[model samples]
Target chain A: MRDSCSRELTCIARSDPRIIILSGDIGNHMFDGFKAEFPDRFYNCGVAEANMISVAAGLALSGYRPFVYTFAAFDLTRCYEQVRIDVCFQNLPVVIIGLGGGLTYAPLGPTHYICEDISILRCLPNMTIVCPADQAEVMASLRSSLDHHGPMYIRINKKNEPCIYTGEPDFSLGRAQLIQDGNDVCIITTGVLLSEVIRAARILEERNISACVVHFHTIKPVDEIMLREVFSRFSVVVSVEEHTLPGGLGGMIAEWMIDNRIKSSDLIRIGTGDYFLTHCLSQKEARDHFGISADLIAGKIADGLNK
Target chain B: MALAAKISGNKYRSFVLMSDGECNEGTVWEAVLLAPVQKLGNLIFIVDNNGWQATGRCDDIMHLNPLADKFKTFGWNSFEVDGHNFEELLNIFHSIPVDSEKPTAIIAHTVKGKGVSFMEGDNNWHYRIPTADDVTRAKAELGLE
Candidate 1:
């Protein structure tokens, strides 16, 4: 996803002279191609994420589209106030690219693990949060960012994420993409976890339970139209994400259900528990530990349906 | 922004007014290191060195004395001036980019509250809003009466 973002950003920079890339001393080699082409457009703001965000905000204020990129944990946590006040409060056109969303950097420990980005960023006004499912969605999101008006947070995995879409699937901000149609259950997932959810849906299908697969690339300003449709149509709606249960896809859909006074469907949220990982684990191991693996997700969905 | 202007061929200059207390933040130094590397001559940072922070004196709390020297050491075109003097400020503002390839950092020395006899140099003024009577007395002190 990061590779796709870099390549797409370079492609965008070719046509749009206003495109600028700012990094927090990370991904120097990853962005080598971009720097080689437009040396003047790329800025390595050193290890200071706060100043990088403010600098991006300053550039955006000057009519330049600046994308601030860094590890998701550092990008959002270390410089949260700057992201909130300088970027979101001012409603600037700065695309904050958070690499290593969720536990992609789990082996690097909790310092690099980010599961609260969506929760915190969602509460900020004028902030649009998009967690791309795969490389194609990453490119599409970057292209859509060019036309977006305010602050945007693009949470992405590091690299080599499983491709959810064969090609770009008519992507747009705040719109949900339906991967497959069913009636018994609707699995609404976001980020790189879409692959696991799809696999889980197939498992449910084999069990004679028709499961719908819906991909929510954009988390904030969530697909309300789809939420209404899915909740009304399907008796069981499951939300899966690589993030924690609170303030992620599940928490968001739960709130939507309550606010809209829709009690027709039983909503089950599948995410990491409200605790940090104590032992060192890989991304896959962490998912399995949290019961977010495909087989586990299918079992949870079946349990929800039986109840 | 200064870098943006330079790259876009815009002659517009970007000015940032900062407080001496704010210098304690790491972000300030991050930008301080960046502007010089980019040689953003179009950027100007004016620090209001009033010596007082929210709770205590700036030097007593953080020791940010010789602020101009700090910027100078950081590869900026540093200058010191009286913040209250409009003529000095205008002159310094007009003579920006003393070095064409360096960013400018102006350390403007000032009192916490100027022109008001009772309020001047009082850190309490940082949070204290003047009452009706205090306002009248302040006006008299500044000859606004």
Candidate 2:
């Protein structure tokens, strides 16, 4: 995902001279190609995420489309206040890239694990949140977000996750993708969890249960039109993501359903329950423990529907 | 600083007005440190070093003593001025440092609640809202007829 971002950003910078990239002193040589070519445009902000965000806002307001990049831990938690006041409140066109989103940094312990960035950023007005499902979606999202005239948060896993989409998606800002059609149940997924949810859908298929797999890459300003269609088509709804239960894709969908008066017999949300993970586990291990893995999701959904 | 460079160059410069407590934030240091790297000659930071923070003295809150020297070390051309002296402020702002390699920091040494006799140097005034009588006394002291 980080590679996709770098590739797309370099592509964008080639055409648009106003595009600038700022980092919080991480990503040692990930941007070597970009730096060698556009030295003036790339700035290493040296572990000061808050300052980098403010400076990005300042740069954005000055007719430059500034993208602030950093570890997910610092990007969301450390510079949240700066993002809220300087970037979001001002409604500037600053692209915030939070790499290693969710449990991707699980090896580094819970300190680096980010599960609530989506919920935290959603509270800020004029904020666009995009958690791409795969590499293709990442490039498409970066292209779409470049022209978006407001603040955008792109949550991406670090490297080598499952690719859910084969080709470049149409990738509008606030749209959802229907991966499969079904009648028994609907499975909605966000971020890297789309891989798990897709597998879960296939598992349900073998059991004579038709499960619809929908990819909700753009969680904020969600594709309500698509969501409405899904609610009417399926009886039991399940939303999954490698994030927390509250203030995430599942939480937003639940709120929207209640507000729109769409009632489902059963609504299941598969995510990290509201608790801090203390153990130092690998990404796969953490997800498996938290019931966010493909097998766990399949079993949970199958059991719920059979009940 | 980049904003200043992009929009109007040296013609329309930018200024940041911050309090002494703001110096405690790592963001301020980061920004100050980066300004030189960009060589933002049109940017200036006016630090209101009033010697007091919310609960205690500025010394107790953070290690911001000799603020000018700290800014200088961080690549900014630093200056100290009596904040109450309007002429001194005007003179300093009128001239940029000959060392045009970086941005400038003006540490304005000020008394808290300036011109308010009772509130001057009193830490309580930081949080206390001035009452009607206090306002009247303040106005009378300043002869705001």
Compared with the true structure, all predictions reach lDDT values of: 0.88, 0.85
lDDT of 1 by residue, A1-307 (tens): 8888999999999999999998865674678899899989987665567878999999999999999998899888888999999999999999999998899988878988888889989889999999888999999999999999999999999888888777657898999999999878889999899999889888988999888899999989888998888887987788888988888888888888889998777888889889998777999999999999999999999988883
TM-score, chain B, model 2, is 0.91
TM-score for chain A, candidates 1 onward in order:
0.98, 0.98
- Cα lDDT of model 1 by residue, B1-145, tens digit: 8889989988888899999978866878889999989989888899998887655666754657789999999999989999999999999998885447889999999987798888888767776779999999988888897
Give the Å error, residue A193, model 1.
Answer: 0.3
Predicted candidate 2 versus true structure: per-residue lDDT over A1-307, tens digit per residue: 8887898888878999998999875565678788888989998665557778999999999999998888888877888888999998999999999898899988778778889899998778999999998888888888888789999999999889888766778788898988888889999988888888888888888888789889888988889999988888888999898999899888998899889888654678989878878778989999998999888899999998983
For model 1 chain A, the run of ten residues with the poorest summed lDDT: A23-32
Question: Candidate 2's residue-wise lDDT over B1-145, tens digit each?
Answer: 4555645544667789998876766877778878888877778999998987654676754567888999888888888999999999999998876437688999999998878799888877765779999999999888894
Model 2's DockQ score: 0.03
**Fnat for each model:** 0.00, 0.04
TM-score (all chains, Cα) for each model: 0.69, 0.69
